[model samples]
Target: MKESVSYAPSRADFTGSPAVAASSASDGPSVKSLVAVTLGNGLEIYDFAVYSFFSVIIGHLFFPASNDYVSLLLAVATFGVGFIMRPLGSMVLGNYADRHGRKAAMTLIMGLMSLGVLMVAFAPTYKDVGIFAPIVLIAGRLLQGFSAGGEVGAATTWLMEAGGHSRRGVRVSWQMTSQGGAALLGAAMGAGLSHLLSDQQLYDWGWRVPFIFGLLIMPVGLYIRRQLPETHSTTAASTVANPALTLWREHRRALVLGILLVMKGTTTFYIIVYYMPAYMVNTLHMPASISYWISLTAALLTLLIPFWGGRLADRLPKRKPILIGCAIVSFLLIWPIFATILYGVPLGYTIALIAVDQILANISAVAMFLLVLETFPKAVRACGMAMVYAVGVSLFGGFAQFNVTWLLKVTNAPMAPAWYLMFCSVVSLAALVAWRERHHDE
Candidate 1:
């Protein structure tokens, strides 16, 4: 029942020895530094999520196929394609972060993310460039995917390393909080665009506005990231020719279990936060604006919930209790939530139900993230987190929308997403139960 792999930290495992005393003396990173790191992450997520928010128009624009269904499938597939490069990005950038420094890796990814957004923001239409239109769009996604692959790992590792041990849970929890903020900002933009713009106007240019906004703020992120203190020391282990090999050889169980542990969160997030807008518009015939507003509301609630969860993580003796509780509750409630939404419940009630689910999912997700962060020793922390996060997201989260779209077309089952989430929940629960806990703090 017990796993052989262990991650007991040594003195070198401290992210940076100099910062430990300073961090422990206070709560965590200075507000300015914390804002810089989390803000960059939020912008990256906004750029990524904006694509899904406007997938319908994006489909009609760049992917222009014979039918609407095929066009949308192609559009979402392009979205998923970006994820295909995540693992590679994680390996390259994650390794770079480990070898160079967290500050260096964070600064580098900002430029790459900006470049990818530029391509999508200004790409020519299918009508203007024919095949080259989609080509440019996909190329942009690939670049974004690559940049993002290493982004989360480096950012989370930095927070963990820079913050005090007692506050690590709340510190790492900001990763999820930033994502919620991204979704919140993205949804507000979507809802506003949908409300203010006509169909012709929205399809013509409204979709590009968010990406352009992301580009405008990216320089600020890059500048701020450069000013942050380095969290990773360039030790001899970091200079290893092949950190990934060492990760696999020494931490195989953690990698495997971590991937499985991440599956439910990624799948649920992409489906609920990204795919639901399309599902409501396409399947239920709801107005796009209504879906956007609903998503906006959920994103707002989710944004505030993670801090509480983070606090809970800090208060608990072990993270497993909250993780298991949330998983089991989510598994039981998912089908009913979807059923209620489909059964013509009041729109207000529907929003409440979605908010409830998001709250539960987010709490568990925060706990899971903290657990994974502690599972790897500092030497390979960035690489390990990047690999686990990127692989799980690329394989499941990246394609969740596309898969559900295909399922609806084939099975015509409105509950398709619920079923998919259920299966993922079972897998996550199994992994959680099997996981051997090591409370590094304790």
Candidate 2:
């Protein structure tokens, strides 16, 4: 099973790499350089998500509200603030990458996030600092948001920019795996932290541990990133490719289309990944440890998401499988997904159910970027991608939990998320129909 899951696709196997002119002497990344980019991606996602797993605890400490839902709502809203900042950073960083170089932007974004996490780790709460407590937390999250908005856009730009034409699919596929792994790590750390502390202690200061830990990881990632040479050569020849000025002129439509597709993904992602664990705790009476354990086990079991869909794209017609995967997630997941939630499920059943949902979503997730790589032409791809993807995530993905909670409260449905996902599926289907295949290589 592990062999099948971790099957490393060779360069000879991937014929989907983007075009470089015959006379152009473009230098693609070495295998080692690709690994660094992908690892950096994984670390960034882990650092970003660490805040969410500790949401309840952090909310209590920083926001200090009496109501459970209110505190959580505040923390989640604060998380949303990061999302709001993302698109702006995309404009700034995407342009910066386009103008300066992907490497410089990547380095700068990492440094910003490292400082943000460091601040959060040692931050004083409402009890200690009054209004300023939450203020600083928000500021740190905003910095994280800015970095995140730029980091992936920059890293992805580097990865896609640096790959060989024959194997862009497979090479970029390896680049995608880090996100799932990082998410799994964040869940594991949250669970481990839960185990380490008494409930009172967790409420007191234990929640801050994950923030500190995430800050510490930045240096390790920085060290790994140091090995890879700059993906974009910082030369005078590409001076016309400044991202801020050019993204609008060169990549506008690609950016717009990207938003629609990514919006579908962001909506579904919050349903299955972000909010599901909290739902388990609230509706099913699962302990924090159990929720963490189940989610982690599920993440571990289906960890090869990038490769699974990526290999299919490498060999088969990329469009059908990609579209089908989206349709399946949009359509098949809602009923059973929420049905299991409503049922008074035991631990075993809950774990199985969550694992299945992860599998369904994972099946189509990497196609999100695969499609992006294909749609946008090379020079402006980074800015185009960042703009559309970030906005889609912000408007649709960022507001997911708050929206559903409000809907559930208003409509009184245990399966409100199912309805929401169904709607997103409808949107994804529309996107699939509208999206043309960009198999210029074919």
lDDT of each: 0.80, 0.67
- The sequence of per-residue lDDT tens digits that candidate 1 reaches over residues 161-271 is 885565666677677878888887886787689889999999888899999998998888889889998877787844555667778998889888999999898888878
Overall local distance difference test of candidate 2:
0.67
User: For candidate 2, lDDT tens digit of each residue in 318-402?
Assistant: 5445666657654875677577657755567656755766665665665667677556654556666677777887888888877
Root-mean-square deviation of each candidate, in angstroms? 5.5, 6.2
In candidate 1, the residue pairs with backbone N, CA or C atoms under 3 Å apart (3 or more residues apart, or in different chains) clash, namely none
Q: Look at candidate 2 and give me any clashing residue pairs.
A: 14-166, 17-165, 95-244
Candidate with the greatest lDDT versus the true structure:
1
Taking all chains together, each candidate's TM-score versus the true structure is: 0.88, 0.84
Q: How many clashes does the backbone of model 1 have?
A: 0
What is the clash count for each candidate, in the order shown?
A: 0, 3
